[model samples]
Target: MIESCSGIYRIKNLSDNKFYIGSAKNLKLRWFDHRKLLRKNAHFNFHLQRAWNLHGESSFEFECIEFCEFEKLIEREQNYLDKYYHLNVLYNLNPTACSQAGMLHNQDTKLKISTALKGRVVTDEHRLALSISWHKSDKCKKQNEEARKKASLSKLGKKESIETRVKKSIAHTGKKQKPHTEETKRKISETKRNKKNVNLIKGDIYAEPS
Candidate 1:
């Protein structure tokens, strides 16, 4: 029976000596996740993904290099990375063995990614999933609120250039606006009633201080 373990691991391409080094809390599960993403061509490490695509799965091997405690995982992984990185055989994009919190893509990589996604259309399901994921994360919510506040502050007293206004007008010209559903209208009405500031006269909706 296979046992769960935490350690530094290596994904080696037999065709070439190039390999990716990583550390995981559960090596087996981490390797499984890597294979799944590589097979789907959606691996976060594009360098490794490209290598896997070129070399084929049969030519690669996943092996544990050192078994270490979870606390020392990053340190151990960093040592291995430092050793192999000097030889230029690593598939890792970043030389630092760390999480992707502050990783910035180079201009070339950013351009390549932008070009690749330029014509891609997000499906409604994918859009909904992204929205749900964003909403579910408190960190994301806080970041979004901060960003919005910063944007509002930055835009305060800013006037649009005539050229910019013209471009926006052209962009919106002939665009059909979707009407809100009855449910949405009902929710709006309920919110207005709760606020006690909204007034309805004839067919116009207005807000007045209560």
Candidate 2:
């Protein structure tokens, strides 16, 4: 598979119990093109598209994938899929195999330019003239830099609110979530009651001695 934006995909055949599993970096573009080819009744048709039409989308699934660096992932996955699914078959021309097998056949014919067209070569004088015309204008540059600095300062000045801080803490705290136990609930209620009592006592103590 072309190591696109790093995604795993599979196309299954409902008619036969066969399946093809592969990965790509750009799953949407790659799959969309595959679907289009199937619509046009193209020869390099994928069985997964057939299964989607025949059995529905629920039939085909790509399982157990983690996004990672492309160079490491594609080679590792290509080998893994080959072993797990026996998908490295040369004769098979489904989506997984067709790209590999038909690559030789799809070689683009190289275009050659016979001769260069004779033209006036720009000298250092011409270069200076163009640079002076465009690069000397400092108004647009200053305006652009000022705008960029204003945006940067605006973003930097945004303080995290209490709600945002709590959310961020919850996300980054490596605590596994669990349902609250009876003991934990009791402790929480006690804490709330203590705080309420403290507030009440403070008001009474601070009141005028009448």
Per-prediction TM-score: 0.48, 0.31
Q: How much lDDT does each candidate structure score? A: 0.77, 0.52
Per-residue lDDT over 15-46 for candidate 1, one digit per residue giving the tens place of the 0 to 100 score: 98899999888889888878876786666666
| Cα-lDDT of candidate 2 | 0.52
* Backbone clash count, each prediction separately: 0, 4
Clashing pairs in 1: none
lDDT of residue 97 for candidate 1: 69
Best by lDDT: 1
Mark the regions of model 1 whose C-alpha exceeds 4 Å error after superposition: 1-3, 100-210
